[model samples]
Target: MKLLLTSGGVTNPTIRAALTDLLGKPIEECHALCVPTAQWGHPMCGPASVRGLLAAEPSFRHLTGLGWASLGALELTALPSIGRERWEPWVRGADVLLVDGGDATYLGHWLRKSGLADLFPSLPDTVWVGVSAGSMVMTPRIGDLFVEWAGAPDDRTLGVVEFSIFPHLDAFPTNTLEAAERWAADIGGPAYAIDEQTAIRVVDGHAEVVSEGRWFQLTR
Candidate 1:
C-alpha cells in the first residue's frame, strides 16, 4: 500500500512539493478525494484542514465533474443524506483519499457510520493520504484530544496502522516528544510524533520520515 501521510494540509508550498515529488508529477496529476471535518461541526470545523488539499489541485471544479480527473471532494456529510447509488460511484472512482484534520472521535464515528472505513481499505488501487486528525484515525488508539472532547476513558480507533500517529505535535499541548515516549511505552509498538510539515510514509509495514520536521519513533 502507498501511503502519503502529511502533518497538516496540502496548502503549504513545501508540503505540496513533497507530495508532488513523491507522487512523481504535479499536484494536479492525481485524483484527490477531500474529506472535510467542518461539516461535522465546531472545534473540528477549521478550514485549514482541507484548504491545502483543495487549493493545491485544480481538477475539483464541481461535484459532478470530479470523475474527469485531478481532484474531487468526497463530502462525507452528503453520503448519509443522499442515495448510495448516486454517490457511491464517486467514492469508488477516487485514486487518492485525502482526509482533513478534525476531532478524531467524530471523524472515526462518521467514517464508520458512512460505511467508508471498511470501503477505503478494501479499495485495492487507492492511496491513503491523511492530515492531522485524519492521520490519527488510522492508528489503533486515539490520543488525549479524543479523551478531552468525547470523554470516553479509552481510545477508539480504526486500527488501519499498527501504531498510533500523533500529528500537529508542535501545536498541541499533549503531543510533546516526551508524551509520545510515554504513549509508546504504554501501548507497545511505536508511536510517531510528527511536527508541523513532517510526514511519515508507511508502505506495506515499514515507515520512514519523508518531510522537513522531526519524527520520533518511540517504543517501550
Candidate 2:
C-alpha cells in the first residue's frame, strides 16, 4: 500500500504542490476521503480532512467528507442525524483514506469503536494518508497529550505501517521534541518525529522522506 503521511493540512502552497506531485496528479484527480478531527477544533464529530484537500485541489472531481464517530468530545454530533447508510457507501468505495489531524488518543478510540480499524484493512485499493493526529495513529502507541479519560483502553491500530509517528514537533513549546525522543528511546523501534510541512512516503513497507522537513529515525 502507498502511504502519504503528512504533518498537517496542506495549507502551504508549496506543500500542496508536493502532495500533488507525490500522488502523481492534481488533487482533483484523486478521491479525497477526509478524516477531519486530525485538527483541534472538532474533537468529537468533525468531518474528515480528505475533503479539505479535494476542495483545495483544482483537479479532484469528487470530495467525500466522512463525519467522525460520536464517541469523541467534540461538538459536531451530526453523524447520527445523517444516518449510517448515507456515509457507508462513500467510505467503502473510497480509493484513498485521508486522516486529518486532531487528538490521536480520541481518534484511535473512535476508529476502533466504529469498526474503522477493522474495515480499513479490508479495502484493497485504498491508500492510507494521514496528517498530525492522523499520522500519530499510524504508530503502535500514542504520546501523552489528551485527558486521562480520553485514551483507548488498549492500543489497537490499523497497523498500516510500522513506526511511531510524532507530529507537531515544532508546535510544542516545552520540550516536545525531547518528549518524542524519550518515547522513541523507550519504544526501541523505528520512530519518526516530523515537523509541520514535512511528510514521509511509505511504499511497500519502505519509508522515505518526501518533504522538506526533519525526519529522524531514532535508534538506541
Candidate 3:
C-alpha cells in the first residue's frame, strides 16, 4: 500500500499532489472510505467530531471533503460482526482510505479486531491517507506521551511503518520542537516531528518528507 502519513490532512498543494499521484488519478475520480473509529477512544472526541468527519464539515475539508467520486464510512469497530465478506469488498473497492485522528493504540486495536490488518498484504495498490493518530498507528511505538486512550496496554501500535511520528508539531502549546525532541528521547528510535503543513510519504518502504512547514528528524 502507498502511505501518506500526515500531522494534519492534505493541507497543501504539494501534499494533495502526492495524494493524487498515489491514487494514480484525479481526486475527483477516486472513491474513498473514511474511518472514524479512533475518535471513539479519545477523550476530546465525541459525537460532534465524528459527525463532522462523516458529513464532510468545513473543518474537515482537507480530508473527508476532498471531493472524491464517492465517499463512504467504514467503521472498523463494526466489521467483526458484519463479516469480512461484506466489508472486505467495501475496502477493496475504494481507491483510498481516509483515516482520521484520535488515539493511535485504539485505532490499532480495532484495525486488528476488525480483521482489517490481515488484509494489508493483499492491498498493494490501495492508498492510505492517515491524519495524526491515524498516521501514528502505522509506527511501532507512539511513546507514552501520545497515548491518551486509557485502555491501551502500552504506547505501541501496528508498526506497519519502521519509524515513529510526532504529529501536530508546533500546532499546540505542548507540541513544540523541543517537546518532540524529548519525546524522541523517551522512545529512542528513528522518528519525525511534522507540523500541520507537513507529511511523510512512504512507498515500498522508502520515505521522503513533503512539507510546506516545519519538520525534523529527531533521532540518529
Candidate 4:
C-alpha cells in the first residue's frame, strides 16, 4: 500500500499534491473510506468528533470533506464480529483509506484484531492517507510522551514504516522542537518531527517528506 502520512489532514497544496500523486487521480474521482476507529481510543474524542468527520464538517474539510466520488465508514472495532469475508470487498473497492488521528496503539490493536493489518500486504495499489495518530500508527513506535490511551501497554505500533513520528510540532505548546528532540532521544532510532503543514510520503518502500512547513529528521 502507498502511504501519505501527515500530522494533520491534507491541509496544504503540497501535501494534497502528494496525496493525488499517490492516488494517481483527482480526489473527486476517488472512492474513499474514513476510519474513525482511532478517535475512539482517545479521551478527547467521542461521538461528536466522529459525527463531524463523517458529515464532512468544515473543521474536517481537509479530510473527509475532500469531495470524493463516494465515501464510507469502516469501523475496525466491528470488523471481527462480522467476519472478513463480508468486509473484504468493502475495503478492496475503495481507492483510498483516510485514517484520522487519536491513539496509534489503540488503532494498531484493532488493525491486528480485525485482521486488516494482515490484509495490507495484498493491497499493493491502495492508498493510505493518515493523520496524526493515523500517521504514527504506521511507524515502529510513537514514544511514551505521545501515549494518551489508558489501555495501551506501550507506545509501539505497527511498524509499517521504519521510523517514528512526533506530530503537531509547534502547533501545541508542548510539541515544541525541544520536546520533539527529547522524544526522539527516547525513541532511539530514525524518526521525524513534522508540523501540521508537513507530511511523509512512502511509495513501495522509499519514504520522502513533502512539506510547506518545518520538519526534522532525527537519527539518534
The candidate scoring highest on lDDT is: 3
Residue-pair clashes per prediction, in order, are 1, 16, 0, 0
lDDT of 1 by residue, 39-143 (tens): 253354545535544564343222212232566678676688886788778877766777766666667777777777767656755666777677777778865
Model 4 per-residue lDDT tens digits across residues 1-220: 9999999889999999999988999999999999999999999999999999889899999899999999999999999999999999999999999999988999999999999999999999899999999999999999988788899999999999999899999998899999999989989989999999999999988999999999999773
TM-score comparison, 3 vs 4, better candidate: 3
Q: Each prediction's Cα RMSD? A: 5.0, 6.7, 0.6, 0.8
Alpha-carbon lDDT, every model: 0.64, 0.57, 0.95, 0.94
User: Model 1, clash count?
Assistant: 1
Worst 10 residues of 1 by lDDT: 59-68
Q: Mind giving the per-residue lDDT tens digits that candidate 2 earns over 70-156?
A: 111211223445655766676666556766656666666666655566665556555666766677677666544432234456544
Model number with the top TM-score: 3
Q: In model 1, which runs have C-alpha deviations exceeding 4 angstroms?
A: 10-18, 21-25, 38-69, 148-154, 172-174, 185-188
Q: Is candidate 1 or candidate 4 better by TM-score?
A: 4
Task: Give lDDT tens digits, candidate 3, residues 7-110.
Answer: 99999999999999999999999999999999999999989999999999999999999999999999999999989999999999999999999999999999
Ranking by lDDT: 3, 4, 1, 2
Error of 2 at 113 (Å): 2.2
